[model samples]
Target: MRVLVTGGAGFIGSAVVRHLVNDKRFDVLSIDKLTYAGTLTSMVSVNDNPLYRFENADVCDKTAITQAMSDFRPDRIMHLAAESHVDRSITGAKDFVETNVLGTFNMLECARAYWQSLDSRAKETFRFLHISTDEVYGSLGKEGLFTESTPYDPSSPYSATKAASDHLAKAWERTYGLPVVISNCSNNYGPFHFPEKLIPLMIINAMEGKSLPVYGSGSNIRDWLFVEDHAKALDLIAERGRVGETYNVGGRNEQRNIDVVNRICTLMDEFRPEHGPHSRLIKCVEDRPGHDARYAIDATKLEQELCWKAVENFDTGIEKTVKWYLENEWWWSPLRQRYKGERLGLLPSGA
Candidate 1:
């Protein structure tokens, strides 16, 4: 299979590309603009492989995207390119809309055009998978999980753009008869994660003896999904999933933000005893604007229909993530230099 993955250099995108090339041995083309959070080095594991290639391109540029689609002639397109950080979006909503909303619109048009040119069998077999976040469902109370049928009530600029893109994807399928499948996933943590995210930031900060910032007393909750498992779910959803359906993929692991930081501290204490009790570095800070109280996904549809199961829970997945950062400084050192641990998402009064 020839699969074209946009944003293939970013955290979750890179995971999908690596699985496609190294495990499935599919001919994969990764198109990325090398944005601040994306680095080609994330795909080093499969870059030299015969089945893998990359193009430096932007999905927001419809002409470039259409040209690449024409050239690659991919059987499957996994649209993952987006400005995905909620905190970043609070300060910079325009970029999120341009990248997530406009980019997805352009990608859908490009995919539809390409699908039209394909022969009957090729068109029937083609798939466009739109990967999104569970944040689109907004905050959950302490009771229920976010099922596939939950109405979207996005609370942040980042998730609002993603919600718009999700709607566009389904509209393309319904209006233009394009074959599209969507997967909204929970928080992902594993290797090659960007340092700005909660998990990696804590790991790297604890390593360097910097303060591990926990926002809003750390009571906010998130369901964690191992990135590799989410990648596998994407593959299955694209391969055999019914078109015009949305699947929720989650690791079934929920943790309070403070507990997550404390767990990381405990892990650091085990791995780097010389650091001597990392929990002392925990520092609670101002909460983000419109921070969701909780997010938990009910992936029963994906689990029952697609038989997808996450292999890593919070305890195991977090241990693996911490170890990866501990062992792979070569991969993260340059990123740390560029990001300097400055806090993000500071909003002024009277919006």
Candidate 2:
């Protein structure tokens, strides 16, 4: 089967593309905007594979995307293109709204036009999977997990735009009979991850003996999913999930921000104890505005309905992630040159 993936050069998107090409042995086309977060090296595994093709294009440009989709004529369209970094979205919300909100609108419109042109059987088989974040449900209290039925109460510009995009995908399904399946997942950490996010940032920073910055009291909690496990879940949802249904995918591994950092520091100490304890590098900083206290997902729907489960717990996953970074400096060094783990999303005093 042929599949088209948006943001295929990105962290999670690259995992999905590689899984499709190398694991499932499917012909794939990855359409990505090649943003600062998107590195071509992520796709090196599939670069020379005959089953894979890539188009350097943005989902915001509906005309170009529509043409690319038409040329690809895919059996499935996995919409993953979005400005996903919450800190970057705080001050840089324009890109988030434009890409996540407006861009989703364009993809829905294009998919509607494309789905209507196919024959009856092809229409029946076609699927458009909208991958999203559980952050759209906002912060959880000390208890409870985000379920598919959870109401969206976004706290950041990033989550707001993602919530908007989620609504748009559902609206298309309800209003136009478009076959749409949505998957909301927890934070993903694994190989080929860009260096900006918390896990990788901490890993690299500890390796360099740089102070590890933890926001506020460092008590914020998040359920972390290994990216490859998420890739497998996405594939299942795209192929077998019911249309107009929302599935929650999570690793069932919830960890506090500080604990996650300390774990990494311990790993670093083990790997290179000559540098002293990495915990000394932990430094609490001003927290990002609208920082959610916690985010966890209940993947019962996905687990029971689709017979899917995450393979890696946070401990196993984090170790693998640290090892991957240790071995793959060639992948992340250039990224570190571009972004030196600077603080982001800080509001000016009395703005």
**Candidates' C-alpha lDDT:** 0.90, 0.90
**Candidate 2: where are CA atoms >4 Å away?**
341-351
Per-residue lDDT of model 1, residues 277-333, tens digit only = 999998888877798999998999999998999988788888999999999999988
My TM-score estimates for the predictions, one after another, are 0.97, 0.97
Residue-wise lDDT of candidate 2 within 1-351, one digit each (tens)?
Answer: 999999999999999999999999999999999988898899898999999999999998978988988999999999998888888887779999999999999999999999999999999999999999998999899999999999999999999999999999999999999999999999999998878788888888888888788888789888889999999999999999999999999988888898998999999888889996999999988877888999889999999999999988888889999999998999999987775445451111100
Q: Output the TM-score of candidate 1.
A: 0.97
Those runs of model 1 whose alpha carbons end farther than 4 Å from true positions after fitting are 341-351
What is the C-alpha local distance difference test score of candidate 2? 0.90
| Clashes found in each candidate (C-alpha, N, C closer than 3 A) | 0, 0
- Looking at candidate 1, the ten consecutive residues that score lowest on lDDT are 342-351
User: lDDT (0-100) at residue 181 of candidate 1?
Assistant: 97
Please list the Cα RMSD from the true structure of every candidate, rounded to 1 decimal place.
Answer: 2.6, 2.7
